[model samples]
Target: MMAKIKEFILLKIVIPIVDMMMGMKISYWYKKINKLNSLSRDKITEWQNRQFRDLIRFAYEHTVYYKEIIDKSGYSIDDFTSTDDICRLPVLTKEIIRQRYSDIVPDNITKIPHRKHSTGGSTGEPLRFIIDENTWGYVTAAKIHAWKTTGFHYGEPFLSFGSSSLFRVNKKNRLHDIYYKLRNAIALNGMNMEDSICRKYIEIARKKRVKYIYGYASSIYILASYVKKHNVKYKLNAVFTTSEVLTPEYRQVIEEAFDSKVMDCYGAHDGGITAFEIERGSYFVGYNTFCEVENPLEISTLYCSNLIDFAFPMLRYEVGDAVVMDNTANTHYNGQIIKKIEGRTGDIIRLKNGHTITNPGFTVVFKQFNVKAYRIKQLSESSLVVTLVVLPNFKKEEESKIIDTIKKYAGDDCEIRVEYIDQFEPLENGKRRFIMSK
Candidate 1:
């Protein structure tokens, strides 16, 4: 009875107070540490290998699913001592994780108490996942690191144009909102990026003296176009673009309008920062994970192992985005190379006529025509609406060439309409989706 009473008191009072104090301490330390240079590639690799081994061992011993796989493969946890040995393990896919979520996660670790989140099914199938206290810590550290790289100081006001669930914005979201506000970051829902909303965002940034702007690359580009069209003036330290492909043309337009250098960051819901742009337009892998670039002739997929996620071990998880790596000699331990993320797997358009094409194919065609940022929407079975944010000096002949290219690539039966707009629309979550099917 006494123990039960003590447990109740701890849950009702002591734990809440402890959580708040710890959060504050972590936030303070995060701000301080993010400014320091990240671990060198060698140290980062070593640390990741150690963590990978530990996570694999833990999963093998505690998770029945992993145990079965390991036992069948005739390999003990000790076999995975080096990074190269990771290739021997079967690649983890989203389908496998979704199908066997409970079995994949170790039973030993208690779930961190928090609300669960489901991905918006933007990729065709919505995925449900748990987000706990540790998830927030890793996310916070990554964001802080990315911002610091682009000269964002802690407590400096900034703007985030991303989606927030309606329920999250209520009293329940108050604590998280307060934490963001304390960091001087405003959460402007990405759904409201129309002309009026874009104007309001500009007004807020100018008024608040927001030093940096970060959001979906497409969303930021839309706002940038609006700013350029209206001649809005607001000096910014930098613009960090994520959650969508940051094409070179998009980067150029954003830099021109915002008057700040545009940096790109790549990550996902299952993992934290995989790559971030540093000086000289080079991308450096983040510290908490080790990644391998499997380069085919035309495309590459990044296989990553999370060094921190012991609760849910992801060994050689296939992050389904294509990348281009630099072919230089010993720069960093794991081949310090730049990554050009070619968008996600779901960024493909399936025609009603039973043909499928990817965003990269369209991108290649767009490059051939030298068009500005564009989006393709399949409006009907035989029709496609291509919208382009017209660049200054864009020619009619070039537009015709783009239409012709689409006709050739998409097929002769499909009717392609090219619309020149001031800017393309951004999604509710601040993602700039290039291909949308209706």
Candidate 2:
């Protein structure tokens, strides 16, 4: 009865109140999404076409970066009739964003309030940008709608696995605890999933009657392995995995352990690309994002444009993932479908002393620096090399801090070396590997 009351309050009173207080239009977006969900394929495409044209025109007129590029390309904003016409514009890469940060922001940025955010260092390129309340509202609504397709409700009791640096349990931040408590969700540290920690989380899930589980693919896989090994049982509505590739092996074990289906979601928050799995191998791209594959029929790079976000226009932005789009469009939801996505995969480094270190542990440490890109190469069991591409603000003294962080995970006696580079050479697959073991 209490859960039902809380759900009602969250979906009704609290959400609207918060939206009004923050000047967010989440309620407005919810209505828009509801309307879109019922529209026919032609209607959806019409909406997409209008939004795409508006985004291109807005960026060309408002942002210095896009204005200069569109002019150089010899194509005016008027030429962009369909989403496919975005190919005429140059692809925006992380390097371009880092170099031309100020130009990408709208000329009237000061007049429009926004929240500054930074992406995770998982891609070796952590990007900082601004997002207005409207974009935030749309993303929130899209996520809720995506999860709802898998029978998840807002304010339900669930467990979320995320970065440890962001979701710590220390008493330093009681509001974090209170926030999750109110949401009826628990946030577990994803970086460290030792057997004991996984066991504690498993017990916590059972005690809390958690109906859904959401988190990184690797962390959830580790927890699922432990659950299967111990013959522990759980009945859940579904497991939603993201941020990394959900391998077949990972999906099978997770479903068997929790007795639920696994739904995979792909999102590039910085690039504003979001898609959720609707069937086994097909993903339904949300109406708000214009997703493009550089080479459509074959496995190629993904570029996206956010139709709603104009505060900082990421036009034709490379999302740094390998994907193959289904040319055979499903006549549902603007006919956009991702047949396969080759998301990031985590690699572990096992020391001679039996201690293991993973990529995410280093990612958390690197997040504090002004690193443009990084790569960790394990030359041998005891020797490791970290190559970094840093911005002008990065100081020499920070090198010691990075070494200390690496030693913290890899052990003090391990031979560590740091080298500075301008940039990295892309692998054959066109994606950068954060960790490499020779």
Which candidate number maximizes TM-score? Answer: 2
Worst 10 residues of 2 by lDDT: 171-180
For model 1, the superposed segments whose C-alpha errors exceed 4 Å read 1-40, 111-115, 120-122, 165-167, 170-177, 296-298, 326-338, 345-438
Give the per-residue lDDT of model 1 (tens digit) for 242-339.
76778777798889997898878777656544567765456766555666677633446767776556556777776665567665543433424554
RMSD per candidate (Å) reads 13.1, 3.3
Whole-model lDDT, model 1: 0.63
lDDT of 2: 0.78
Q: Tell me, by lDDT, which candidate is best.
A: 2
TM-score of 2: 0.88
Model 1, residue 289: displacement in angstroms?
1.2
lDDT of 2 at 60: 83
Per-residue lDDT tens digits for candidate 2, residues 273-297, read 6788878888888778888887887
The deviation in Å at residue 383 for candidate 2 is 7.2
